[model samples]
Target: MGRTSDAKEKILSAAQSLIELRGYSALGVAEICKAAGVPKGSFYYFFESKEALALAVIDEHWAGQKQDWTGILNSDAQPLDRLRQLFEVTEAGQRAGQQSCGTVSGCLFGNLTLEMSNQTEAIRTRLQEIFDAQVEMVDSVITEALARDEVAVTDTREAARSVVAQLEGQVLFAKLYNNTHRLSPLWANCLALLGARVPQEALAGS
Candidate 1:
């Protein structure tokens, strides 16, 4: 049972990494099996089809992201500072990917949203829920900030969605251009959009 679970875990990790690198439509089961060091028979034993495996991948990705987001969004710092920390985390991840792959790989959820949304109903529905959940998390942070008078956002939900959309759009552009510079101004721009204080250091460095 331990080995069986390990194999499933490896397959999920490999498929997610490959999907981030190559996109969903371009990868196949054989490649996934090879990358995971699992046999085709074992893959089927765990997942009924590629679509099922993709759904698992989405679950895995969101679980990990939510864990991090919980910490960032629930911090005791000022709400805008927590939002700054989230963008810092994103820029760091993209920079690390650029250092490794010579390009920013972008967010997996956004990637799947663009690729498989129209083709797979189950995957598309799951993606929608995940993104909506993410937006709600951000909205909570925004609402709290509004309550405290730490930041000013007229419509909490809309402001949160705009921030998310801007970040995703910046990541897509950076990945498309294979350059992290495309993301340089994004953090500052997002702060401005929310009418949050543009910290001097963030404005100067970013």
Candidate 2:
């Protein structure tokens, strides 16, 4: 049972990497199985279909994201500083060649929201819930910062949404341009939007 679980995790990780490099439409079950070193029989045993596997991949991605974000939020550092570190993790991922986020790989949820929302209500609803949860997490962090007087945002919810939007936009831009340069301005904008003590000149230059 443990070995079977490990195989399933390996397949999900491979699928995630492949989907990030090539959008979902370009990936195939055979490729995922090959990358994972699992047979097609095992793949079928674990996932009923490619769509099911995709959903699993999404769940795995969000699980990892939640863990990382929770750690950031619970850290002893100042809230705003913790947020900056979040961006730093993003930049580090890009630098480390994880150039795209699984959730934003062609903006998975966004793409599905447009293409499959009508056909696959379950997937669409799940995707929406995941994104909403992400936004709520950010809002909770920002709200705490406001309560502590560590930041001065006019609206914590809107500020959190803006941060999410900026990050999503950066991912889209990076994917479109095939370069991380498009993300530089977004980091600056996020800091400004959060009312962080970013230098005016630096923000302007970014």
Predicted structure with the largest TM-score when compared to the true one:
1
lDDT of 1: 0.87
lDDT of 1 by residue, 104-129 (tens): 89999999998989999999999989
In model 1, the runs with Cα more than 4 Å from the true position are: 197-206
The TM-scores of all predictions, comma-separated, are 0.91, 0.81
Report every candidate's CA lDDT: 0.87, 0.75
lDDT of 2 at 68: 87
Tens digit per residue, CA lDDT, model 2, 1-206? 33898889989999978866665767889999999998888998999998898789878877887798789877888777777788777656665563344333445556556556676667787888988887887898788888887667888888999898888777677656757666667656766777765567645345
